[model samples]
Target: MDFCIVDWGAISSIAAALIASFTAIYIYFQWRNQKGAEVIANEAKQNIQDILEIIKIVSLIRQKSSALERSRNFIDFNRLYESVVRSSLYIDDCVEIKDFKKAIDEFFNCCLKFKEFESLYRDYAQDSKFIAHVDSEINLIQIRGFNIVNTLIPYSIYQKKFKFRKK
Candidate 1:
């Protein structure tokens, strides 16, 4: 009878050990899955941030283009066109995404139209009254776009260089 009781005790202990080992294995796999999920979530967040920055930049470019269109007579179209070109290059070099191509194409179209008006507006820069104001506005637009581009740079390097500037 004592031998029978000892055998039962040993069997129960082995059963408990087996259960604990299975539980530990299950927990490890669950932890691994959770870690992978967290990594995916973080990547998604980063992608969203990048997309948002691109959207804001595209909107700013559109607004600038609209302003230039309205100020055709008041602004130096050729200089404004050149500013747009510079911004396009900045976008292309800084961001590899193709979504900006449309905004860039619109800007190119504006440049082409400005080319038609180039012969007329080319000499307008010599007129001190128009040149001064146009140059100021052009500089403002260029600065705005350039600052926004600067913002798109990774937060690590970008923040170091452009800490106080608002985009």
Candidate 2:
């Protein structure tokens, strides 16, 4: 007679544990990926909103207005600018976004120059030279602002839904 020992019970137990572990790990990863997508989508929505508000404020700055109205515009824009800067805390700032920020800073500097020019020479506000300067500023802003808009457009969540086109 020959005697041999085999542990079938132990082998089955080990196989079951391994399968359970693998399934758990797979589920965990899938959940994590879903959460990540949600976060990115939320961030995109927020960043796009901030950018649009900034653009609108810039538009206001371009328009000719009374000194009091311009002062109100300044107040509004200051608040918007601060919000945009604060948004960087949650937003994943890409190169285009960073460029947009730099553009905003430059615009604020231009705004200051305009404000001073208007204050010191209120009569000159309608002068050809001042009007020409404002026009030149508008021209520069059009070029720079549109370029940034192009880059940031891709980040908008509603592009596909709204059927946006590339220009």
Candidate 3:
């Protein structure tokens, strides 16, 4: 009688190698996905913080009750402009965001109007009538800042963007 032999030891070793390879691939992909999620979360958090800071700066600028305080607004305005420009990159400027960028551009115009009006209001501090007229213009510009910040800081818009991207 003749007997045939099977290489059980080699077969088991090959099976072990295949299992390890598959496990390594699975772990790598899972790690990559988790890292991607961490990055997205950090971006969203940064954006929200920036939006709130912008709104707070606008409020501080608006709350100036004296010509001297408002006159010094250029410093705060500069900070606001820099913050907005820097945050724009982090603001999720994807095509799906629609005219969110247009609103951001509108801030430049709003800040310019505030700066000009405040300067006028401050320059004619000695004249009563000119101060009155300057006050009207400055008040209007402040209101514009208020409106713009309202639109920019809404959580619903950011939430929608975040949720859409999370998918």
- What TM-score does structure 2 among the candidates reach? 0.57
For model 1, name the residue pairs that clash. Answer: none
Assess candidate 2 and give its lDDT: 0.56
- The global Cα lDDT (0 to 1) of model 3 is 0.56
Residue-wise lDDT of candidate 3 within 77-97, one digit each (tens)? 566556656655445442234
Work out the TM-score per prediction: 0.37, 0.57, 0.51
Q: Measured by C-alpha RMSD in angstroms, how accurate is candidate 1?
A: 14.0
lDDT of each: 0.46, 0.56, 0.56
RMSD of each: 14.0, 7.1, 6.2
Candidate with the larger TM-score of 1 and 3: 3
Q: Candidate 1 or 2, higher TM-score?
A: 2
Off by over 4 Å in 1: 1-6, 65-167
What ranges in model 2 sit over 4 Å off? 1-6, 88-90, 93-124, 127-167
Q: Candidate 2 at residue 125, lDDT?
A: 57
For model 1, residues 59-86, the per-residue Cα lDDT tens digits are 3433453445534533444454455466
